[model samples]
Target: MHPFKMLSEYGPLLLEGAWLTIQLSGLALLIGALLAMPMSVARCSPRAWLSVPVRIYISFFRGTPMLAQLFLVYFGAGQFRHELQAVDLWWLFRDPFYCALLTFVLNTTAYQAELLRGGILGVPRGEVEAARAYGMSAWLRYRLIVMPHAYRIAFPALGNEVILLLKGSAIASVVTLFDLMGQTRAIFAKSFDFSIYLWAALLYLLITMVIVRIWRYLEKRINPHLQRRVIQAPKAVKTAVTATE
Candidate 1:
């Protein structure tokens, strides 16, 4: 079948899948970001007690594949079914959708927290010292100065992470969750049409383009001072004429 006709027939199914992909990615990013903030702080703390556990958490998640994490949550949890049921938590771990969501959120948080930690460490010591000289409290310094600067430095990296998360959401299909990739696979399996996969790839590309554009727009908004100035001829010409006059 022609690509357009195939799309016309299966467009709604594809759209539904895309919507699920968006929801999964968006929720994971939001919740992951929230969790990562404190994790980043802990990871950067001076005390070993505070930072060591965070280091381990980040290392394990970052070191392992996301698919493994999803599998552990979705399938491996079955081994603990009795324990989970006793705690009234079986409902969360039993559902593929919830398991996928949990895995993605946890996985993203590990990566994001490290990015944020890098951002935090990148803050200039001199600026921090200046804040200290101004008699700012530690909390005030973090809230007013440190975090803002950290986020500014980390924005591009965080945006990249979000894009990666969006792509990674395709793994949801592996856990029996019908995301865009899953739906595409189903269509291909049924129709035996190669064009459907092409359509899915194009849709993924479109989504990526949209994400990149939004990130660029936000970069401009976040750090407008970094934008290049259109250097025109210096007013030196007008100044020379006025002086001659």
Candidate 2:
């Protein structure tokens, strides 16, 4: 069967599923980015007490499989029905959507936090020193010098993590989110044809290609200096280098 015909039959349903996937991913990423910044900052602090828990958090999340973590938080945590009910926070845990969102947020935040921390630490010391010498306050130093460079370094790494999260959304199906992968799985079960899986794979590949293009565009915009085809050094600088040699 041709791919177009297959899509024509189930295109609407798949589109709806893909839309949900996009929605879920967007919200999860927004929430994850917000949560990750402070956690990254905490991890970089000199105080062992502050950094220790962050270390454990990133270690725990990154160490475990996301699906296992989801299962533990959803089914495992739900078992504490009485305690959770007493606290009135059970509503959040009870809803599969919330649980899935929470799981994605926490998992991705831990990952992004580590990346951000690495990016921050990777900032050039000389640039930071120059900023400080220019009467830039600590906050200003971070805001102007550190943040830009850190983000420049973290941008590609963070983009990869986002793509990983996009793919990971498929795991939400097991929890009943009925996102793209989940809906496709249901369709596949009903039809008993592998074509659904193939279609789903194509859809995922298309989405990933979009993300790749976006990352490439961002990489160019964020570092205009880096986009040069060739850089010509000035005669004075070249002469100084030759004299030093």
Candidate 3:
């Protein structure tokens, strides 16, 4: 089949797959971020017991391949199907979509937690001390001060993780989920055209570019100080130019 004709015929299938990819990646990132914050905090705790388990969790997920994690959640759990069914949770394990989601969430959470931990630790001691001087409770200090700073610091890295997760989501095809890559593979199998892969690659690139733009907009919104500097720089330069003239 001609590439354009293949696209016209299968375009809806590809779009549906792309939408699933977006949904999967977006949901995983949201859930991962939520889990990462607490894991980051626990990892930062001074007590060995508190930090050790978190450290291990982070290490295990970060060190292993995402594909292995997916299989572990999907097929590996099949080994205990009787127990899961008895508990009425087998339905979740039986679905490839849910298994892939669980794996993505857990895998992303580990990496994101470490990014958040670094961001938290990067918060200036002076600001924390100032919050303490104001008699802010620990929770208040974290909520009002530390978390704000930490997220700001972590935003760039978190954005990068989101992109990685989005690309990595293609692996969902391995378990039979008809995400973009899965659909592409199916179409290519019938058509035997290499351009189908190129089409899929372009779609992925377009999605990535859109995500990068969204991240930039968010960074501008969150860090008004940087925006202000950007706004003022040209005005300052203009003033100096006028004086010289």
Candidate 4:
């Protein structure tokens, strides 16, 4: 079959898959970011009681493969179906989409927490001292000084994390979620067409390109002071003498 005809037939399915991919990735990133904020603050706490548990959580997720995590949530939940059903939470665990979303949220939360912790630690000590010298309360200091700076420092890495999660969401296909990779596999199964995979690859690349461009734009907007300023040499003034006496 000609490529155009193939695309015309499969385009809608691919679009649907792409939308599902975006939904899964976007929600996971947003929720993970929200959860990460407080977790990160706790992770950086001086008290072991506050920090150790968070450290362990981050280690487990970051140390293990995301695919393994997804499998654990999806398949492992079945082992305790009765327990989950007893609590009326089985409906959430049994659905592959929710299971996948939960796994992504858990996994990304660990990474994002670490990123934020690093950002928080990266804040300049002098600036923090200055804030304290101004008699700012801890909450006021964090609000006016620490968090804004930490987020700015972490912004680029956070964007990269989002891209990684978007690509990694392909793993959701294993649980029968019908994301982009899953749809591509289904199309290939029906037509045995090699070109379908190429189309999927292009679609993935297109999505990635869009994300990168948007990230760059937002990064520039947030870090305007970091933007490069072009310095132009002053033009030499030309004094023309009509007639030299």
Candidate 5:
């Protein structure tokens, strides 16, 4: 079959796979971010008990390869099938999609928590002191001041994390999840067409470009102060230039 004809025939399948990829990555990033909030705070705690466990978790996830983590959840769950079945929770682990999702959430949560911890620490002490001076409760301060500023500081890194997670989601194909890469591989097996891989690459690049644009827009919206302000020439100078022209 002609390459374009092959693409035309399988384009919808590729799109469906791309959509699945987006869903997987988007959910992981959302859940990871939510879980990261408390973990980040715990990571910042002065108490050893509070910080140590979070430190260990972050270290383990960050230190390990994501593929290993995915395998542990997807394949390792079988090792405890009887125990899981006894607990009536085997259904969740038995599905490859859920196993992949669980692994992604765990991995992204660790990285996001560390990023947020850095952001929280970067919050200016004087700003925090001023909030304290205003008689704000700890929770209130976190809600009103600290978290917002921290998110602003960490927004770029968080965007990078999401992009990384999106790319990493391709590994889900290893577990039999029909993500974009999985579909590409399937099509390649039948068609023996190398161009299918190129199409997959283009789709990945297009998705990434969309994500980058959206992230940049959100970053600007959230941190308007960081955007450079446009300055206009003085009215007199403009008039003089206009007259000269």
Candidate 6:
């Protein structure tokens, strides 16, 4: 069948795949954000031990390709099944979907931590100093002042990461998860039509566009300071100002 006709024929199946795509991406972002919060604080802590391991973890995960990580969890983890079973964590790691979710969570946590770390560091020292002068404790000072400012500064970049990871949930296909990409591939295997694959492509594009729209809306709402740079037109000359005064 021609690509366009095949697209119409398979529209419902592709929509199913797209729905799954949104599900996986949404889960990853929510879970990833939750995981990153503490990791960010740990990296910024004064303690070398706390920061060093986090730095290494971020370096290792972000530095490596996500596909490799998925493989490590899915195939490689089986190599350690006996050890994991001893700790009663094997069931969680053994399932392919669990492994994929775990990989997405871990990967996003590393990236989000750095975004947060940059945000925290960018918080004005004066705000913290003032908070201290007011007799607020260490935790209170950071909570009341530093975290808010730091997060606002780097939000655009973090928004980008959130969108990217959401789209990247398609890669869970490689680990045998029936995510959007995987389901599309499965359908194409039976139909033997290149156009089935094209429908899959369209499904991905549709979800991606929706994600872009959502991020644009959210980034606008979250970062008011970014609006400060809109250059205003110069006011009408003061030729009439004397009459007004």
Q: Write the per-residue lDDT of candidate 5 for residues 1-245, one digit (tens) a residue.
A: 78779878999989999999999999999999999999999999999999999999999999999999999998899999999999999999999999999999999999999999989999999999999999999999998999999999999999999899999999999999889999999998988889899999999999999999999999999999999998799999989988999
Clashing pairs in 6: 119-150
Q: What is the TM-score of each candidate against the true structure?
A: 0.93, 0.89, 0.92, 0.94, 0.94, 0.86
lDDT of 4 by residue, 11-102 (tens): 99999999999999999999999999889999999999999999999999999999999999999999999999999999999899999999
For all candidates in order, the CA lDDT equals 0.93, 0.89, 0.93, 0.94, 0.95, 0.81
Clashes of each: 0, 0, 0, 0, 0, 1
Better by lDDT, candidate 6 or 5 = 5
- Positional deviation of residue 66's Cα in model 5 after best superposition, in angstroms: 0.5
* Leading candidate by TM-score: 5
Candidate 3 lDDT tens digits, 72-168: 9999999999999999999999999999999999999999999999999999999999999999999999899999999999999999999999999
Query: Candidate 1: where are CA atoms >4 Å away?
Result: 234-245
Error of 2 at 196 (Å): 0.9
The digit string of per-residue lDDT tens for model 1 on 56-97 reads 999999999999999988999999999999999999998988
lDDT of 6 by residue, 121-148 (tens): 8888888889989999978877778777
Off by over 4 Å in 6: 2-5, 228-235, 238-245
Ranked candidates (lDDT, high to low): 5, 4, 3, 1, 2, 6
Task: Please say which candidate is ahead in lDDT: 1 or 5.
Answer: 5
Choose the strongest candidate by lDDT. 5
Candidate 2: segments with Cα more than 4 A from true spot: 1-5, 230-245
Better of 2 and 5 by TM-score: 5
Q: Candidate 1 overall Cα lDDT vs. reference? A: 0.93
Q: Candidate 5's error at 18, in angstroms?
A: 0.2
Worst 10 residues of 2 by lDDT: 223-232
